[model samples]
Target: MTGVPASAAGGTGAKRVPAPKGKLGAAAVNQASLWNIANILTMVRLVLVPAFVVLLFQDGGYDPAWRAWAWAAFAVAMITDVFDGHLARTYNLVTDFGKIADPIADKAIMAAGLISLSVLGDLPWWVTSVILVREIGITLMRFWVIRLAVIPASRGGKAKTLAQGVAVGMYVLALTGPLATLRFWVMALAVVLTVLTGLDYVRDAVVIRRRAIVALRVAEAEAGAVEDSGASGDSASDEAGESAAAESTR
Candidate 1:
């Protein structure tokens, strides 16, 4: 048998794959540049957590000077949290990475600070426990639903963060002598706000969960329909081929 030409065999007939297109390509590009200002702030918050821990435990066990430094570090971290969002919204720099990292950073710092203080006997264990449970629970919930729909931070969530920051700050300041009673009162108000905000987050989570369930069901139904349509098309093409074969035989 004559040898097949190289071009006919494989040289020039190979298909050229086109570059990626549409929303998938766009999403890939977006994901590639996920790091931004908000993410940087989140990283800063994470870094401050260890510093706060060291100040609370290793460096200067709730001493006035150390406490002041701790408070300042915490304040700066919290301030970055606020500014990151402001910059993200104002400058249109919001990214999926920022959305994920910001809350995680908040929870990490708050948990570290609260846990350290509780260990040091500054904060009551029950109070820290409640806050920690809520924070951790909500964070898990957020992760579970993140793939379906992004749950933006609610107003109550923001208030909760503010209350926590203020309360923790006052508690740290209380380590110093000046205005100890005033700081105690401030902390009490912060506690009240914290409780209210916690409840609000619970309510918001319930709504988000319900919405996520609905979205999931809708997506599943759509996917199933597409699969069924594809199967039907395959069946029709097979039937058409059989009919053509019969006609040729006839």
Candidate 2:
């Protein structure tokens, strides 16, 4: 009783309504603000994507100065990605705009950097295409089940994103000696992680859709049962009234 609500004090038979969770929480998030700090950071990240590409392809060659600056811009964008998400969650500022825009920014940045890498012939075109398909496909799946379920970024997904960034960053810097060889293996590992995480997301989406469907059916069934009970009670009252009238007439 120290901090409980008044309704819970005396067993007065009043039902206290609780806040909704699960998919209902997703609905609430979808309806929230797009004007928050988190969303602003995400928008900034989107804008930086093309800027990174431009700096990357400048002078038509791997000029050291241009490559260094390109890597710096990419690094800043990724840093914003980390901060925006942390600030949003810590401050309860999760919004649908952030949800959709954040992932788009993430994938777009990777696509921009990786595509630039392949175009410059530092990385293979086939690797770029595979990573692009996986990223785009998973992102699309996220939106497909967005309203029904807000899937928080998984740890494996985060690791995959980090691997992508590290691999791309190392390549962007045009590292020499052992580090260049290391970057190749890292890029390979990122590709494997990308495919694995994509499959995990597909499995998650299916489970979420099933759960939402089951919840909907349960809600409908409860409403129907309540209506039938009310109808039965009304019929009983009518019959009792008729019996009482017959007795009075006799």
Candidate 3:
């Protein structure tokens, strides 16, 4: 950075020659291809979201056959969500596109499932509303702090997601007998985890945001000190040059 040409920094309407490998710039260099297998699977999940919704509503929405097929489609979408993340991490195939689209796909699919259930009388309206607020709020929080901090998903959050999928899946099946009790318990746990994890995420975001602001201030102060040191050095050099010239003239 120190040796970089001043001309490069102060160029006036002049196009600078870019490095050969920097055709798309430095950030793009590290970005993975959008068409990777992980991303494709994510897109497939998005497609299946609407499929799941349509299947859930088919034939007046109460038909046993329709519910069976709907559950199967939803199950497939959930399965893909598990693999897409694994594949992305394992293959280092994560891209900017994936980072954005993947979450949107996830939230969209989950929202469709929860909303559909509420609409079909399988879930209480208040439960759906609570979960939806948490889901949407946390998602917004992520983007809000994206520039200053990163809040990775916690184990509780992941468990909550799994719980939701399982609970919703069971409800779609309209299961009978002893399994109904099991479903009720699972759904209860899912709701509890959902609320808890939502609170946890909010707390984490607040802490991270505060720390980030502190870090930024420290960085700025250090930069200012560096600039001051550089300015002092230049002033000393100029004074030395002037003193020598005056002595020679005397």
lDDT of 1 at 249: 100
Between candidates 1 and 3, the lDDT winner = 3
* Candidate 2 segments whose C-alpha is farther than 4 A from its true place: 1-36
For residues 127-152, write the lDDT of model 3, one tens digit per residue: 78888898999999998998998999
The clash count of every prediction, one per candidate, is 0, 0, 0
lDDT of each: 0.76, 0.87, 0.87
Error of 3 at 81 (Å): 0.1
lDDT agreement of model 3 with the native = 0.87
Give a tens-digit lDDT track for model 2, residues 127-178. 8998899887877887898878877789999999999999999999968999
- TM value for model 1: 0.67
Sliding window of 10 residues with minimal summed lDDT for model 2: 22-31
Whole-model lDDT for model 2 versus the true structure?
0.87
Q: Residues 164-227, candidate 1, lDDT per residue (tens digit)?
A: 8887877765445666666667667666767777677677777887988998899999999999
Q: Provide the lowest-lDDT 10-residue window in model 3.
A: 22-31
Q: Candidate 3: deviation at residue 113, Å?
A: 1.2
lDDT of 1 at 73: 87
Model 1 steric clash pairs: none
